[model samples]
Target: MRTLAAFFLCVCALPLWAQEDAGALAREAGAQLEAASVRLAEAESARNRVRALTDTVHAYEAGLSAMRAGLRRAAIREAQLRAQLQARDAEIAQLVAVLQTLTPDEAPTAFLHPDGPNGTARAGMLLAELTPALNQRAAQLRKDLSDVESLRLLQEQAAAQLQTGLTEVQTARSALNQAMAERTDLPQRFSEDPVRTAILIASAETLDAFSSGLASIVEGDVGWTPPEVDDLIGEFPMPARGVILRRAGEPDAAGIARPGILLATRPGTLVSAPTAATLRYVGPLLDFGTVTILEPRPGTLIVLAGMAVSYGKTGQIIAASTPLGLMGGLPASNGPSTGGEGGGAERSETLYIEVRENNVPMDPLEWFSTEQDG
Candidate 1:
């Protein structure tokens, strides 16, 4: 009976211990998930803040651009006004000189002069006209001075506004950085879910690849050109000489249509921006290692391909010729040492370039000018 009792007790304890273990794991997972959630929230918030700040900076930059334009306009207006003022001053001086040369028409003194009876009426008429003319000149001078003061005030106000906007950008950037730092603890907390974490990591990696691809397209190593119907827009720089394996809009060996030019480059060379524009998208595509889209100007899009390394972010405004990443592979040599076709192919890296106008694919070759026909 004691043995049977002992067996029952063991079975009961086993369930209790199992429940305890499950509960502990549940608690740990919950905590981890919560931490990750918080971190994600913070990251999103920081991203938002950064976006707002970027917009603010753009606004300020736009304002500054306007201010520069206004300044030019103001300068032109001021020059014209000054010219007018100078002309008026010169006229006044000339009039004053003439006045000095002429005697002020005094009431005709018949005792001192002969034939004075007819002269007084004409003299009175002349004096009336001269007095009004002198008053008008003085009023114009005052108006010109007032206008100059107003223009100066406008210039100062525009300058102050532009500066304030610039400061706001910096403030926003600092806030975003703080948020990012606070959220840095989230990844550690989520380490329990290796599968979910891997998914997230993969997604991030895909984004990075797409971003890199966008940069490689701008390098223009491919025999790139826009469609015959499109016009030249802009481009960025590329590192290491590369040959185009597949042209943009061309079919691959499997008859797969590609969106951008593909260049065989060193494996890990940095990519670069083709033009100054906002990054519209960064992510994966079928067969494409990575893809990135940039709107360099309004309605103009550039696509890059084969990018496994990228340095820019979506919605970010990158400058023309800015380094997106470094040459990402081994140095090229004369002999095909190991893996690929040409001597350069021994190191297998590629950069692809694509251009789009109004979201429609165009040839990149039309935009890029080079002494080399390639």
Candidate 2:
């Protein structure tokens, strides 16, 4: 009977041992699930970060594009104002011509007589009428002149603002580039997390391509040189004709250094090369809107600033007098052309010409091929 009892006790203990073993296995499985949950959370966090960074980059790029377009529009407005002023001038000239024919000499003493002195009284009355009319006409002309002046001023202000805007855009771009650099290693954090890693790679690749494209834009092509003009050995490139509204080294209203010459040119005028070589990079530059940088040979980079429009692309081949772009902004009907041989445009312009020999800035005046027309 005691042997039977012993066997029964052993059987009961076997079920309890089996239960303990099953519980231990369940705990181990739960721990693994918890670890997986933590890893998944980390992956989600990385993906969110990548998405945010990508969106920020896109936003900045869009802003830069908009700023460039705005600069172009502002330039066009300046041209339009010049045309309007010219029209007013032409009208004033016509009025002056009419006045010259109407009044050949000073009024005679007889015409001023108040008594009934034959037809002299009638002439006096006519003079009275003409006097007021002429005065009114003169006043109108003066008003028109004032308007033209104001418009011209507005154009100058706008151009300045546009330049500032361009600078801001460039600065913002630089900031974004820095931010991207700082976050360069953030993608690596996702390496162990497969889902996040995929997202990170995609975002990084997109950014990398964008940066590469920008870099390729800076590596310009050959520059064009003016034949028979050996004197412009170190000058920045310029159009064949025009004035410089803003000279290099001139401080702007805000006392900022305006680094390039702003050329004033006629609308639809052909802008030529200062020298001849291979065309290099032609694209939008920081604060310069549409620009063409020609690397004639290996060391020289001639930058054409403030294009109202662009016709070429990165790595495009161009020639001297080649139409890289239209005279951006408004082309003046009677206003000064900014792209000519003189100082910049007759109207408002902020030409930011920069000559770099092996990436170092040089004074453009040293190599100016033409006389100072401004």
Across 147-177, the per-residue lDDT of candidate 2 in tens digits comes to 4465455445444443433333233323333
What would the TM-score be for candidate 2 when compared with the true structure? 0.35
lDDT of every predicted structure (CA atoms): 0.46, 0.45
Q: Model 1: runs farther than 4 Å from truth?
A: 1-51, 87-89, 96-115, 153-161, 173-291, 294-301, 304-354, 357-374
RMSD of 1: 32.1
Which candidate has the highest lDDT of all?
Answer: 1
Model 2: C-alpha RMSD to truth?
38.0
Please estimate how well model 1 matches the true structure, expressed as its whole-model Cα lDDT: 0.46
lDDT of 1 by residue, 85-201 (tens): 675565556545544534544754532324364555565555565555545444555766676676666656554543443333233333434443343221110012334333543
